[model samples]
Target: MASPPVILLLVSLLFCIATQRLYAEQAPNYTFVKEASEVSPLQGRFDYIIVGGGTAGCPLAATLSSRYRVLVLERGGVPYGNSNITRLENFPRTIADDRPDSPAQRFVSTDGVISSRARVLGGSSCLNAGFYSRASPEYVAHLGWNGTLVNESYPWVEAVVANVPIVQQWQSGVRNGLLEVGILPYNGQTFDHIVGTKVGGSIFDAEGNRHTAADLLEYANPDNITVLLHANVHRVLFRTRGRNQPLAYGVAYTDNTGSTHRAYLERNTRQSEIILCAGALGTPQLMMLSGIGPAEHLRSFNISVLVDNPGVGAGMADNPMNAIFVPSPTPVETDLIQVVGITPFGSFIEAASGLSGYAGATSNSDDFEPYLGIMSPQIGQLATYPPGERTQERIAEAVAQLKVAVAANNPAALGGGFILEKVFGPLSNGNLRLLTTNVSDNPAVTFNYFADPADLQACVQGIQTIEQVINSGSFTDFRYPQTSTAFLLNLTSSLPINYIPKHTNDSTSLEQFCRDTVTTIWHYHGGSQVGRVVSPTYHVLGVDALRIIDGSTWNFSPGTNPQATVMMLGRYMGVEILREREQS
Candidate 1:
């Protein structure tokens, strides 16, 4: 044995080595600036300026930073230390919080459909249901994307945040029920596109910690990337010459301190570009603000039209979700989405549990007022327009009536249970338009949920399919004695209301119930669609040095949860951008 003094010294050296390694792992390697002043004089130019440090933005920035000097400006704060955001149990709180700066910014549509978008650095990936699935192979082919590149890029994202979910008792039953209902032959657990009931990946790891796209920044080149949080880019700066197409050279943004800043691309470099990774709403809003939208709409707001592109904010689509709250006699395990039922009829069914307590405890009317206060101005404007005027008025009136109905009863809160959401794929009629010139103002969004008629029929079928699954033998023991809608209405029957009862088994009643309660499952896409708003290469039409790579770029909604597809597209764009620069 060595002497005591020698042993002590050796132990000390080992401890020091371990300490350094621990610090290295814990400390972030990339340059993260919280304020604009921190990075001022702002470096004047960057090889790439990516707005919206979101699901697509984070990975895109990471990939580009490997070979280029990149700047990522995010409107929300970093996601590292937010407790409500990090914990799975607090998922509802994060989405329900009405504060203006909440991680999930809630909004009610022109048609009174309520939904939200992620306002954190990782975008919706930070606020979503954590379900992860790739776009169907048909969707991939529809976009005509480079299939080999897409296949290779998915692993890069999966390696960072994807995990095999722990299938609890409730989830296992869901899987069986899905199969029994003719949703498949079970495809088993997979990340691939299979036309059957399957278990998909999740962003939540084994410990239930959410790994967001922001985590992918760990792969970034520390020396080449600068991520600035709360840096909201309001518009893309454009330079125009007498009749030639406009060129985007920079962006104007406001930092957390309300200080304005501008970042530009170098004049001589063809490689420099400004990419918008802002989600469906933000991306199109920015395009219209920067003068790239409908000429008449832009002119109404006194915005100088740069491109006269009518398609910038058109064709918005969302998964119209109808809920069935099955009250469990015993508390079910608190979980996010695990098992998914993909119907051949273009609607996808997924189940989530442990939110019944929250849903029951909160009265809709009490929550409706504040949410409406933020949205009323926009909806009020839509009510002034033609074609949708009557529909908008009815929605506003329904919300107003619900406020009156819930306040008097103050319904008893239900215990923890499950919620089933039915997501429908792309319908071509939804739209988003600027309500005002201000970038901070929420845009007017209309999902046109049931306008397609075929979409409405699909939803009606989907609701029936889920009811079948819940009523199946697999869920016999766990089944609620009453239908979910009946339990929901029982919690609120203070008056002799004229509306239909929740337990009405007829197709007409179910269809009516769907129309009354239909809201977004929060999968919003296609404001800046590929081949219309932007080229297939992800570059904006009628403008040089500008690109958009986010949900807004999708021509239509993916058949499954869109975050995985969005990330894959981001990775593809980042790789293609680099390749293009090299070729140029």
Candidate 2:
């Protein structure tokens, strides 16, 4: 089952040498990478074409590159060197940014929840808390995937990016708090999504740096992979044979310059494929945009129906998050999610501290919103000092030294953390529909969280469970404004902690709290369910030479965060495709 040690070592060295060759094209730096503007019309087609260079796209492209020429078209720019993406502390700043070039693109779901999606090369992985957990064995069996292959696929991704986080004080307290609430046996430091409370992996490293899906490109044979940035794919081109289903042959996309370019599969090879690794939102929207959704919906947009599959934009699910802000009198360490409690009630409990990196006490001050700009306000504050404290030259020196945000850790410096519960197995689901012909515009979607009575009861259970944890001995000391007999519970707003909904009143129940405070944990899935929109093997139904391999194709969102499984699916599909080709 294994190759000899010497042979394995030799193969590894050869791969290293090949990688060097790719990055070595410094004179034409990023020879394998180019802005869509720099790339001319394709003189040659590729063996495989991947759309969306985010979380799944990059890995899928890399795995295919080992044996086939692959092309990746990404709408957003590269993620390298972008501080908002590379630095752990800038996560809040990154997500808050809504500028045209911002890596995180903001979109409000029809559910009235504001959320953001990944718009950079690494996709949402660059913007998320970087929590990495594999889907449970149950999830794999439910999807009917090859269990062995799924396990094999994850290790490669983890080796590339996952890290054992240095669980700091705040996260430790949260872990203890979870145990106090009786979430059950603590499974320490594992990446598996099991039935107990556990500390999982993250993409953020010990040095507080991030490694995104883009990093997985190192596994590719660079000579066989071409990546184009700022390439927004508009539609998939199809060719129909007489009395046969239509086949995908190519894609048309636009560059930043507004010029359109087309890339196609290699001529005369039925093996060639055009895969959609775009996330849930993008994948389904693209199908509809390319005329593969419900006939009535496509007809409304003047798009000719190719497949008329109503399932393309149906069954949208988002894990609803109910969270509370916990303030600490004593300083707590800055951190993102580390420990998670997998409750038997179909909820996952987690926490994050020190976001926004404020160096003062946490407050309800309206002025706190200014930190949303993050660096600018602090940099401006750096300029104001007593005459003796800093002369103009001294200010300049201080400013230069502080430019890298060396002090931005421990948002708990403001003295708090966020304890959040995300509902798993949410019964409520919704749909996605086109708003405009523009591919860049967000298609309207509604997750309809808590639409089902069971879902609301689950959220209420999670809230009541958190109340017990807060009242527990392990976390009681962390509650700030200790002046009260207990908590400063407002008549209108009570339970858990501070800054709750103003609409909550004396008679408000935990169910009311669940509805009033619901937000997104960003693990969106469905819209293209297996056995509806695609084959179990990921091929798009009613079409040939096309596949959809992202969270969009999932029947349910798996694990605490879906990034790990999304990245794994990319690798799993690539290996399966290659294996099938070899066998053929």
Candidate 3:
């Protein structure tokens, strides 16, 4: 029944997916990459030593490798061919996995919200929902970036690690629902960080395979890049000059075998450097460890101070998020944040559906053999370690249940999805500090969600917008109601915010909803700002030949998702570094 043009498009897409999968499997073999243990001396000199081979680090290393000998030291293993990260449907499990070797590192902030950061070579780009939107024009100008160079850098990142997503059944419905709520006139599809409803780009390909920043390493001259995995950098080595600021010379890192190794920039290499792309949390933590932070704080850890600066881990901020879960009438296709509703009140609405079970194989007493329980016709439950549950049996039961539910046209029987809102430009801020001298341990951070009254007001507005979308005609088919009226998601407040009349006695209830349900979108930034801790060129202040390039540099998050700008930043700076050297 389909038209020829539509059918031909589908065929072409399928072919493209198949080709990408084959290309991934047949990726280039780089003889330069090795486990830290494989390298004998474990000490060398390079033109640049970049710590943390993450979303930004990989691209920066690849670009710099074209002109200089570059070394990238990643504390985690590779993400290639990892099913947990590659498959779009396995997102929940990937975020919930908490093992020591897992690519996702789970941590709870002092503010009491659960979050995760990437420990894989591709960095958080490997762990995120794969959304790709550039920084707003306002943000680019605010940072004093070269507008021409910034524009030129984006396509390079997109060509290797991004794609135009195929908007499907669930996403299409959400997009309509967003428009119905009066979020704006639809902007159709775009990768720009604009104001309106739009289908954003993704790092995931048509085949449900994730192409991470690690894939950008293909652009590197393999002969010039020496990447070492399982390399945990401890501190930056510095050489002090008489009555002058110290100069960073190298780094000391521990390998998988608990043996330490030192890698450095040659003493005579002109304008050589050490770069930290260890992310917001890791970069500031490393600076403090290297005795470059608050004098009293570094003294507490028995680290002798080289340069005292209290700004190392100040101004920590994360966008607070709230959500509602709605079950659908039919199976929704697997997707993550394909459509977004950019609100006028500094909030962004997004959704993801069909995430699988959340069970991680951790060596804890709580590890359980989970089973699906049909508690009632309308409800399903997860069992914790029910005697001896087999993986095959669990799969069989799930498939059988799904088939029956679909045949019966039972909306309540199907798995539900989530609609979430995250407030932008959060005024609230917190700080990050070390618990011990161990650089390997997760540091203590507190992102004071909704600490500012202004942020709470924005959250109230965003939630009200979501209420309109839920009550809209476009979303009616997605919900199964028990009554002719309506039912609201209970977010564990005094009552669901929508249940009360809009002209209620007090607006205090809506503010209460913001505090009680505060969560994270994991878009945290600003431990090291450009003006405070680093120069406009990302060079660390008061330290020679050291630079920091990552999400930590920004006081304001670039876009709804920060990965696109972060990746672009790396490439932009890399080109600048090469151009400076060439001109000189």
Candidate 4:
């Protein structure tokens, strides 16, 4: 039996969902000319021409089309109801695929570094962790922006997209214990009251699917957005009027057939603009190809210099992460998508709640600010030992407890069970550099991890915290044994600082073990930055009508997810462009 209020609420929610789905499923008023050949070469020039259909490009097109004739060019195919877009059900399994649908999934650039950008119509949004994290207050203030976390940005992003948490039922017991014992003690206010904590574990859509940009931007009236997939842009064609003055006319692009063509927005008859929403990699590549970068570099590439913006591509960073492993107690049966974990103060809760005043928090999206972890009966008792040996003891105890729990729950495993592990955490600084002048080449990326000692310390703290939680007597008769991801791999001395020269079979130091075993979470950012490459208006310095509006333009990599910020800029910049038009 359920309370009347609860039942009514459920009914209303279901109704709203059904209506929204129905609205999305209906075809737009205009019949889309799917084939490129259908639209004549001069099908009346549009009011706005946007390149790249990833994070910023998609939303920009959607918003601009509200009042203007907008055309969005995408180098990849469209992604809708495609398993390739929403296939990331498990966190561990998300990284197994090489062909992620986002920009970051692409080949290495000229710099010999892996450039992760998707060629699909949905861009990298089709290939991401599906984890949502908002920009922090401290971060906004540091960037010299006046907008509060609860006021301007987060709320705006929530309105247009779905960012609910995906919970995993079976892994709650184990995850909760880790939060209670390990993370809470050290991080004090860092993880408390964040958005990621709402759902006890990972959350899924009502249909049990991962949420993505494609999922969010599926508003009615698809006629406004014509996603031209497999249409890669080679350059932005500009006409020169004077010695120093240049006018942006249209863009030159290549279709899937490798044939070059051009498209333009209205110039004099209508107030129009060109938005370079081609993401970090594509934006700069387009600029350089259009001769809008450092004069020296452009000359090297044999490109005619248009705007000599020295900061076109520089200042790169990313989020580095480490993993923690645990053994399950029982035969877990629920989804293990993503478990919520918390700290003490306003950390996880605040993110979930949308800063302090609930500015970005919305009722329509799944509220996942509280349930941040997973647990199971399989997590048993603690094992005690000497200071250095405590790690081993705890591992053994957890393993034994899980064996018994699994046998009791399934009886088919004969006391044998699987082990659980966490993959990522916070990051340190890293960088990306231009490998060559060729746009076809990949850039050289250097993670430069452990370059800062704090990263290593965080990892050590993470390990110690896990040990403390398992040993805190939260579970019953458990035999905590000891085996570490660091120790088992014999990666002791490979850390940035503790690289000691040793012969084969040399013993590993404790510090070496910690460093060698850890890996990256793979959230790269900031190849081009504000106050460095582009201005606050997102205009690349010295360019007549060029702007960069993606995660790469961020001054600092955001603490949480980057999609909302990227999308917000698309909306905000679109307004800026409109305002510029109004004044002119």
TM per candidate: 0.83, 0.85, 0.85, 0.69
List candidate 1 stretches off by more than 4 Å: 1-29, 355-416, 481-508
- Better candidate by TM-score, 1 or 3: 3
lDDT of 3 at 495: 25
Q: Give the lDDT of residue 343 in candidate 4.
A: 38
* Per-residue accuracy of model 4 over 69-167 as CA lDDT, tens digit each: 777777765554354344332222222223323333434322222224566655665655444445556666676654642345445555645444433
In the range 435-479, model 2's lDDT, one tens digit per residue, is 998899999999887889888988888877766776677886676
Top candidate, metric TM-score: 3
Q: Give a tens-digit lDDT track for model 3, residues 40-106.
A: 5756589999999999999999999998999999999887656667766455455545567778776
Order the candidates by TM-score, highest first — what do you get?
Answer: 3, 2, 1, 4
- Give the clashing residue pairs of candidate 1, or none: none
- Clash totals for all candidate models: 0, 3, 1, 79
Q: lDDT tens digits, residues 1-584, model 1? A: 89999999999978865653353234344565455656665865789999999989999999999998899999887666665566555465566554667777766677765567778888888877798999878888888888899999999999988999999867777788889989997999998867789999999876566778988888888888888877888989988977378888899998767888898887778778999999999999999999999999999999999989899998888777765555455445667788888888877777776422222345442433311211122223112223223243554564454445445542222233444556556563578998877777789998777777777777778777777877888876556565554544332222111122334333345566666656566788888987789988888999888999898877567757888988887788899988988887
Candidate 1 lDDT trough over 10 residues, lowest sum? 370-379
Predictions in order: lDDT? 0.73, 0.77, 0.77, 0.49
Q: For residue 35, what is the lDDT in candidate 4? A: 38
